[model samples]
Target: MAISTVEATGARVAVVTGGSGGIGSRTAVRLAEDGLAVVVGYTANRDAADAVVTEITANGGAAVAVRVDVADEQAVAAVFDTAEDRFGGVDVVVHAAARMRLSPLADLDLAVLDDMHRTNIRGTFVVARQAARRLRDGGAVITFSSSVVGLAFPEYGAYSASKGAVEALTLILARELRGRNITVNAVAPGPTATELFLQGKDAGTIARLADQPPLRRLGTPADVAEVVAFLAGPGHWINGQVVRANGGIV
Candidate 1:
């Protein structure tokens, strides 16, 4: 496929934060498959990160793994630095590193809320700010949200609140970068079959959720990655939108 308007300035480099495994890892590979040099940023599990890099390299795609703490501006800055030094300027930034703890608001622990926001809200700001200042003339910044924000399910009050903040930041940043030709958007996935989501979930609960979507299946990491790849490569016009890649759950 020919490069879209988002690559007007030759946006061929991508950074995927929290990319050691799960959705982030898949996204890194997907972007690389689109011919972008990928920087896989992971906070821990270097082995997992190395594995991702290996897969991409084995596929003849350029990739490197960088350790990053989404909440640490300096660390995140380093991820961007590595991208420039190793590949070139960043053309796409996918912030997929986040924490989620489920609990009823009535029994929600304040400490848990603090922890989640520190990574979800503050971390998003640190990374998105860098993307805003450093992304090429025409590029994209994709953030992760959850369909629970719309579902209003039990035990998701704090989690959804944090994602709500993500949505707000995503929209405002898109407008803030109005003339830069950069697209800022968020992908809110629902009932994805990821280790993070499956932990502690009973089979009955999982089955119920899988059946809720019109498609009657849990979303795969590849499912959401495809959406991110579109935004990074060809779907340049879908700006400031919170795409519900939730299999019609909403």
Candidate 2:
């Protein structure tokens, strides 16, 4: 599948928030591959966002880069409005926007927890709310969770808490949309080999983390993207579930 094939129809549009970064970037491209016009939303890093747009365009896929902070209602509304105006209406929403703050519960700073909550919990709600409003009746909404929510790692308390909220939101949102044919779900990924995962780790630390997965390897952006594509495209029946793309890592 190529972007050109997607541009041919031009009615299906997908919104991928935080698309300038790891999993979000790959998921945007993969959706384009599956024939959906893509809206790449970013908070910062216009260059990265533009690069994704350029790549899609160069490949003959229709895409645009939109800057919006998903945490703000007005900003998220603007993103949906742009998608409606540019590509007809939203058919898929991949809510990949998130903030990561790692600290043990004993040492966790309240400010850090608050900031993460603002982005992960509030941001997801804002986007999901807009998605609930603007998405076509049969459209799908994909939110991001984390494998740490299962592992209960020591230093991941703040991040895990935010994702826990997301899990709850996904479940209720799917129920709220019942009988509407709209599917809502979350994707929880293990330690993937992205810039975000590399930020605070040495190579040995990264390798040790990778070794923990049953597959004995870290995940790739494409690994998670494939799962997103499935939920957005063929996995419509998988509603209100947190599909883990963690390569068997708990």
TM-score of each model, in listed order = 0.94, 0.95
TM-score of 1: 0.94
lDDT of 1 by residue, 1-250 (tens): 0111122123399989989888999999999888898888888788899888888877778788888889999999988888786667899999999998999888989999999999999999999999999999888999999999999999889989999999999999999998988999999999999998998899999999999999999999999999989988854579999999999987
- Candidate number of the best TM-score: 2
Cα-based lDDT at residue 148, candidate 1: 93
lDDT of 2 by residue, 1-250 (tens): 0122234355689999989989999999999888889999998998899888878887878888889899899989988887887788999999998889778899989998999899999999999999988899888999999999999988998899899999999999999998879889999999999888779889898898899988999999999999999999854579999998988986
- Can you give the lDDT of residue 104 in candidate 1? 84
How many residue pairs clash (N, CA or C atoms closer than 3 angstroms) in each of the candidate models, in the order given? Answer: 0, 0
Q: Please, what is the whole-model Cα lDDT of each candidate in the order they appear?
A: 0.89, 0.89
Candidate 2: global Cα-lDDT? 0.89
